[model samples]
Target chain A: MTEATFDACIQAILKGDKQGLRDIYDAYLDYIYRIVYGVVGSREDAEDITSEFFIKLWQQADRYKAGSGHKAYLATIARNMAIDHTRKYKKEVLESFTQESDDDVVIEPVSSDNTEAEVIEDIAIKEAIGKLNPKEQQIINMKILSEMTFQEISDILKCPMGTVTWRYREAIKKLRRYGYYEES
Target chain B: MKNLEKEYKDQIDREVPDLWSRIEAGVDAYEAEKKAAGTAPSSTPVTETPTNITPIRKKNVISIITRITAVAACVLILAATVKVTQRTKSESAAPAADAAMSEMPQNTNEPENIQHAEEASEATEAPDYISPITEAEADAEPSNSYKPIAGADSDKNASPSLSPSESAVIKDPVTFDDARDDLLPQLEALGFKLIKDFVFEDSVDKRSLSDDVISDDIDIRVASFTDSKTSDKYYVVYTVNDDGAADILIVRKADNTGDILYTNPSYKNK
Candidate 1:
């Protein structure tokens, strides 16, 4: 959805355009999926949470305030929903992550030519992302995957922008230590 | 700004399986449940509003409902018009339909009201069926128990006393309402959404399709003359979401459907 369409989209959604919800979903699904999947570190739990997250979008579209960047707003909802899901099924999700093990976490060097598709290497990055605290994980993912600005991250997190950028910086250093950084 | 998006963007993280469709399914289920419960399902929004809807938002909600109601009504009328016109096309049906049309109380009823009054009047005459031919015939087919309707108003002469004969049809003066709800979905299913439908009081080439009638696919056409040659034309307009891209379709009144003249991608990306 375009920035200009926030009001129209919200109104259409409330008015029962499942397509309107689809439009919002089209715009932010990957972004939200990235956030939740980054944090949960399990594709299954992430899928379940992302599905519930948008089901929430349908039942609660009217709650969306006009003029707020829907990306930031939706990312926050996704982040919170994933956190709640992990907390509820913490043992199961953690056990699965630990069992998968961090042997995949050894990231390969970023090739000067960045065209290689990394299946295991991507898992390494996700596993590396999984190690950060929830807040740190979210800040970095929102910035990178969601293309959210530091200010919007701060607004969604309700923290200082300085803290958001700093946490993202620290998260990157941590991921680099985990061998996830692309030097090129 | 150094970022992971460009570097790892192309890297294959296991892409979620067509995630939107799954989310769409979830929404469909929620809506289905709300419908089954006899209460409308409200969607979930990311920003949390209080449990109680704010008064201003409440008004917005009411307006949304009203718009939907209006759209549904318009679809009903459009569907009715399509049915009646299509019925009139069949062989040997014209004279009776002419009777129905003449019997039609053209006295100031809105198109919808005229439609309902026609259907109600038709219902009074032919009590067996109220729906259109395809729908009725679908049920009527392969059934030994069913009797085919003789004419559009087969029972007109039988029910002499209740007849909405010329005078009675006039006396009742059924009033049709003009408002219609959003039929964007139906329009989309028809292959496009009508951004506008209207008669331009002046040269239409300069005027765009009116947005006021977003839900109305009602076709309006007029014949005029600049010298002696007749200048008759028809048009349809459609808009796509996001890009605000629209296409003006030149449609013939003989058929409600239109072909895309071309698309104007001017609505978005400004």
Candidate 2:
């Protein structure tokens, strides 16, 4: 959706219009779901968190300042909700998941009732992503799924922009090595 | 690659069930919850109290501490000023009093009259001390009544984590008032007169500091000080970024260059 339309939807939501939220949900459900799914790696958890994210947006619509990048705003909230969910329920897995930080963004292959060929291809991509450490997987998810800038990702991750960029480059390199990406 | 990104997004679209219905239901449930709790969600902004209480508590603690410190400082300054004024008044009045006594008839037998005169003078001068303390109390009262950044209270009520602009008020390592309080004296001592000091509530579009137009999406505090001798101006730009890092720079008006007076170690290490 265009920034103008997104902003209008936020304004509408602020004014207590459900249609505005519906418009936003219709526009960005896949976008938010993809980011959440990428972080949590469980379809059920992703669904739960994605729903909570929208509800959160509905509740906190007034907090959104007009003219700020709504996509980044959505991505930030979606990603945070997903991470928070992981931290809440899957603490043990997270404790051993990474020594880097508490943001244990584990991207396992999600089992879905898709055609075998599609499932296989999806698994290949998931496996490729899963090969990297949790941090790299997170960088890949945000960069690819949400198309967040390294700086935006850095802000979200509380890491330096230089480190974000370097990690993104490393993740891309690893993906290339896994034969998923062709060098441009 | 774009293909990988597209595939990943598309796969999620195909795999993850649309939770819009559940989300819609969740919003309905939230409204109902608010209604049951006796809050009309439509009229009042619904605050998630569980997450909000901590930060508001923290803000209250900080605000109270700041108010107490301001009142204490004001009291100390007033006390010092009163002490100096009293000393000066006694020193000036000594010679005049001696001359007046010499011009008067000897009153050694009427020491009670002298005591009465001194008591009257004390009674008259007592109000001056009382008035300044009252003025000092008046001055300290406004510290508790700062104009909060626009929507800042609501923002604080809404979320534990602050938005970029909102965090400018909350998460800055050193706030504008604190910086001004500390730096103004140092700047004055360095022979600089404060020209203008203000905060950019929104992201500055293009603030020309030392010929450089800064358009970063960070809340900035700009304090301009003029050199007392040269009348040359220096701009102190204190930026509080969204990531909770802050920086302060001093830029010379003539040179069009700035020196980093302070950088948050988090920012510098990053």
Candidate 3:
């Protein structure tokens, strides 16, 4: 995941090197999977988007500017793929059932992470994350899993930094209130 | 809250499946597609979703269109086959019917389905216009020289319901021709020479024929005779000629079933 390695990967991709893509996939799989899983809340959907994300990386090697952050570029694509998947899935559901605008429906997700599902792997914290709204889970996954900054989160979410931080703080408070942690 | 965040980060992350095989295959396919598309002679910048051209969906659309085109081709072929079959039947049917007609003189198998032809021939052969030749007359005449002038253009709306005025619109050419031709020889057998054959428009008020008729256009031909020895007025006839179809046949429909709202004797028009 070093800048030099990332640049080499991009160069190899431009030359149609499958190994280069594999190297990138190996590094970012968990990070990207968490981003997709956090948004879509389904392991199956996460794998599809994650696999597709690496292929897009290989295909769009030319698009990545050398100096800009490589992980950020990847995170953006992952978030977009997840968002696009959600929109499409919602649209299909709407079409199959009845004609109603999907924008009106709030996205309340039970997060993919689970504390009770296992003792290790931050089970309590992960379970608490699940109780948070879908966007909150997405932001927390980006923050904790990918180390994306509040400003970077704001940029991707297309909102103010303050709003991103407020959601992050609010998400933490909601997790605590769910009784995994005592009231501060 | 800080403890929770610390604990969340401290815990080992969950591992996703080692998708090396699937992802590598996908990436290889993607690179192969890009290489192939790059070689294509076009300049639109490619999209990034790695599957901008959805393979299954594109196939489905083409499949539906192919099915539609196949159906259209089938319809066209079936229509052509039907048309050819009908033509074969018509061409073959006409000759066979003519043969059957030649077999019987007075006894045409006038099927009830052919209402117009039966009514036209039978109803119009009233005692006033014709009298059956006697046995002595028949003995002198050749048996076949007097066949009913084969069927008139029966499709002409020769309705039995036609007003006498409308009925007159159709000149009895077949009846007149058959009778004249048959009788001329019989009269000659007795002793008479045909003096002159003249064709003139029947001066009967042509307007009564129909609004579509012009008096000048109606040709009424007649043959006059005198006795060879006595030179007495023997016979004359209104002519019936089939050298030309009765009138201009106007086939306006694709069915090739031509139509005429009304017709009268005229120089046969196509």
Which residue segments of model 2 deviate by more than 4 Å? A92-124, A127-139, A146-174, A182-184, B43-270
State the fnat of candidate 1 relative to the true structure. 0.36
lDDT tens readout by residue for model 2, B79-160:
9999788646543443322222231122323434332332333333332211211223333432221123555454322333
Please give the CA lDDT of all the candidate structures.
0.48, 0.56, 0.50
| Local lDDT at A69 for model 2 | 88
- Residue-wise lDDT of candidate 1 within B1-270, one digit each (tens)? 233555444342447656777877777777677656544346434353453245446768888999999999999999999877754553123232233333222222233432333334343333221122112332333121112133334442332223223212211112111111212222222222222343322444312343223222212212111111122223434222212212222222212332222121221111
* lDDT of residue B31 for candidate 1: 68
TM-score of each: 0.35, 0.40, 0.37
Rank by DockQ (best first)? 2, 3, 1
Q: If you assessed candidate 2 against the hidden native complex, which CAPRI class would it receive? A: incorrect
- Model 3 lDDT at residue B169: 47
lDDT of 1 at A42: 63
Top of the candidates by TM-score = 2
Q: What value of lDDT does candidate 1 attain over all alpha carbons?
A: 0.48
DockQ for each candidate?
Answer: 0.15, 0.20, 0.16
Candidate 3 per-residue lDDT over residues B1-270, each given as its tens digit: 236645554442454777677777876675566556643211112543445446545767888999999999999999999978864654343332222222221222332212232223243222211112222222343222111223533432232233444334433546445545544532322112332342223553333222233232333343334433343332232223243212221101111221221121222121
Show the lowest summed lDDT stretch of 10 residues, model 1 chain B.
B171-180
